[model samples]
Target: MPRAVRPDRSINAEDYQHAPRPVAAMPKDYAPGEEIAPHSHRRAQLLYAVSGVMRITAEEMPAGQAAARPKGIWIVPPQRAVWIPSGCEHEVRMVGPVQMRTLYVEPDAAPGLPAQCRVIEVSGLLRELILALMDEPLDYAPDSRGAAVARLLLQELVAVEALPLHLPQPRDVRLQAVCRQIEARIGEELPLEDIARDAGMSSRTLARLFRRETGIGFQQWRQQARLAEALARLAAGQPVGIVATDLGYAGTAAFTAMFRRSLGTTPSRYFETRAPSPAARGRSR
Candidate 1:
């Protein structure tokens, strides 16, 4: 398979933020498998999934050494943006066709944004303002109303909170195979050794790779994966027992224990406590 080609995109941050040019718009029908490469910017970025879903991978670098392999950010529609702090190295992939909007904000305006990756709500007014800015002609006057609206858009962005959904990936083929197995048989319970064998590695090797890639051992990732799957089923009104059994747990009690350990809430309580899903933002919640 051909790897996605990262686009070589550049815009002068000073000119972009202060020149009063209208905001650039993203295409309505966007396809996945496009790469944005390993790049950094002085300006912070707000990546919004206007429709469909996207996956984001981020790496932390210190002193210019390449860090660990990137993990996952599963972004869907309704929630508008993923706030990336300045100087962070990240990559993006589309799960489906997505219509995404990206707002590059001034570095000074970034302090109020999320310190880490998160999902933020996009209100109707804010969304419209962003769209309108995109519609504005380039070379717009600095004193134009569009510039004022741009300022307001920045303010509204600060008020949005980042909701997190991180899924870790492994570099080792053994660990990668283990993860693939779990995803394939999500509805079945498989022994650890069996999973290791499928991955063509010993259980010990698999465990070590799991720690290296995901920062968690095999069992923990599995439990979290189970809980993640359960959350989706429950949101779809699946019965608790059915969800539990489907995930290969002994019963609802077993599933609840794992869910609480990972998410700090029981299955029943989590759904109740979480704010309602954004409009059309339904997934295995």
Candidate 2:
């Protein structure tokens, strides 16, 4: 069997952003902690990591309107991808050694593609399609094998389920400050009253504001923040016990319960089940 093509780390995705092809695949590897600075593209993007995890911050802008405020944060692990609409500014930080497979799709190529930024579950078929397209040239013939794969990939994108991996940011300055504190002290058990008082608002007002702005209660938002940090640390190879303790859980059992409730699996089992087979990894090389 032929060896899979190695990704050229030096290649820039921007160079092929305007290629004649409706879809272009870019494979890049990043070291742990490496970050892609804020930038936007003319084409929409599906950002997937075959291994490791990524935390992405993005802001969307409708056509002919000024850019909106930073919208939300998405924590994308293996088996999931974040869809970024055309002209949305975003930045990505790798939580571990990352093998990123991204598709840049022309906005008009697929009808009904999401207009807002979201995290979607990547099916195994879609993953394979993306990997196959990476083996083809960016400007392959319209009727070629690559084009067929790209068409199927776009179809899959429209059908994939969106995940609840988003952490929406609030526009209110007071809520933003409270959220920042919660994130900064993710491991601590922060009381709502204390946080509200610190932000110069009463507890009732704070709770209402949280629900109004983020669509979740204060504790729920805090747990989601903890979940994001826990995922990043776990992806970086931290032990379950350490992650649990660091996140202020009473014990591994408590942390595991929370993690399972939020993600449908324990920490150990979550990464274990999502890990690609050796053959699959080899094919995606």
Candidate 3:
């Protein structure tokens, strides 16, 4: 299903381009089904969801990026942020009621960060820094204490591990067909050859193209897709057994194991631990 766009006016590059300082933070609150139309930014963005879930869909990513780089529609759970590199076209939608706190960083300021988008784990200290910096002016002086905080935020971003909540999107028509098929019947494990045949290609050819376009093997990609679906359903308070069964797992244990392996936590535990705190509630300036 196509994601619902936000009824509010869309935010775009001009909103932050030529920011006076290296980093600028803004706060935004979104209702469920709210969305931003396709847009890009000159500055890289750390799209942090403080109170709710969001789904981000990118236009085709730039070339030569690795698998570790996130692509496609990313599910932003609480306490997590999606790092969008400079100049990448993407759209955003809030899955539930969302408190969005975004930090826009100049591309040149963060040298060691990922060139492509990925979901980064937000540490407690980093989260505090983001909140504190929200009060800082975009043109805050570089040598000021506020600038020091921004510097610390940059240090925190370096090599931050990516969460596997992103679903890789393939651009090729054949691979798009295969991915759509998997998403439509996500409850069943379609054989590789069958998927390939439906895409009008041999199994080997499909396998190669899938990885080339999406940065992971077909199996792993499908698994990620399932996990992504599982996240939205699980967040809706669906029962574990139902979610597991709906995602094509034979039983709850099988599904639980996959969830744990993929995210280092079980379904029940992930939701329990990730509830938003009140401090995350902030308004757009």
Candidate 4:
């Protein structure tokens, strides 16, 4: 295929969404506490964080449904990316100074991609592929180096594993209200009975609704919510003691234990490691 004209790299995503290419990579930086307002994309997106963390909230609409419901919250740390399907309404909040490298893939260009939003692990090879593609022309020739990288990127994505860094939200208005309150008072130890009463439902009914709508029980959902918050705070360079205390953990040890149980690592160690270094990337290539 002949090369198409490339848009200005400094512009927003709207500039590249209509490009005549299977995949286009863009680099953007965000300051801590910056927020991208709610929006939708015509092409699917692989939002990768080279550093820092991103807290993304997306709305998922069932097939043939007119209205969309909150899917869940995903906490994306370094060396990880979130796959957002085409036309999915989503918003992002930066947990730290984020160096984001994103790829927008045409819907028909990549088959077998996930239909739902998910946080996926970005392997060393995939990371390098994304970085390399960022330096290529937007409309690279089909037989060019950029095209080769794009093909491998799509192949890697097909086999990428989804992470458990999601906190599912409920569809019911009453449950949504309860979830919002829980998120707001994440540091508080609110009793199930009191929360249910405030929502105008019995504890048993509230628990059932949580399980039915979110595929997780109330306590599990609460724990997941806490975990999501902790990841953001920790990624922002907060001390373990402070994050633990702010999130209602009794002590640093308890918080560390919880982090280990959920993510298989301590908070300090998780943020200590980052995307592969330049030397490592060279070796991989």
lDDT of each: 0.60, 0.82, 0.79, 0.83
Which one wins on lDDT? Answer: 4
lDDT of 3 by residue, 1-285 (tens): 322222232244476677788888776787888889887887888998776787899744543354443448788877788988887878898887777888888888977977767887788888888877765666779788779999999999885888988787877867778888899999998899888777788999999988888878989988998988888787767899999988889999999999999999888877775533344544342
The clash numbers for all candidates, in the given order, read 3, 0, 1, 0
Off by over 4 Å in 1: 1-25, 32-42, 60-70, 138-143, 170-177, 192-220, 223-285
User: How many Å off is the CA of 83 in candidate 1?
Assistant: 2.2
- The order by descending TM-score is 2, 4, 3, 1
**Lowest summed lDDT over 10 consecutive residues: which window, candidate 1?**
2-11
State the lDDT of candidate 4 residue by residue for 71-171, as single tens digits: 77888987789998888888999887887888999988777888888998787789889888877888899999999999999999888878889888888
Ranking by lDDT: 4, 2, 3, 1
Q: What are the per-residue Cα lDDT tens digits for candidate 2 across 1-285?
A: 544444442258887688879988887778889998988899999988888899998874434455445468999987678999988888999887788888899989988998888887777788788878777787789889988999999999888777778898888999999989999999999889999999998999999988988878888888989999998888778999999999999999999999989878888877775644332353322
lDDT of 2: 0.82
lDDT of 1 by residue, 1-285 (tens): 322111222233344444334343322335555555656655566776656455566653321344553544434333355777666667776655555656666556534655555656566677666655554544546788767777778778778754434556777766767777897788777888888887787988878878977787787777656755665466546789999898898988988887777656786765452222232222211
For model 2, the stretches where C-alpha displacement exceeds 4 angstroms are 6-10, 60-67, 273-285
Task: Report the Cα lDDT for residue 182, model 3.
Answer: 90
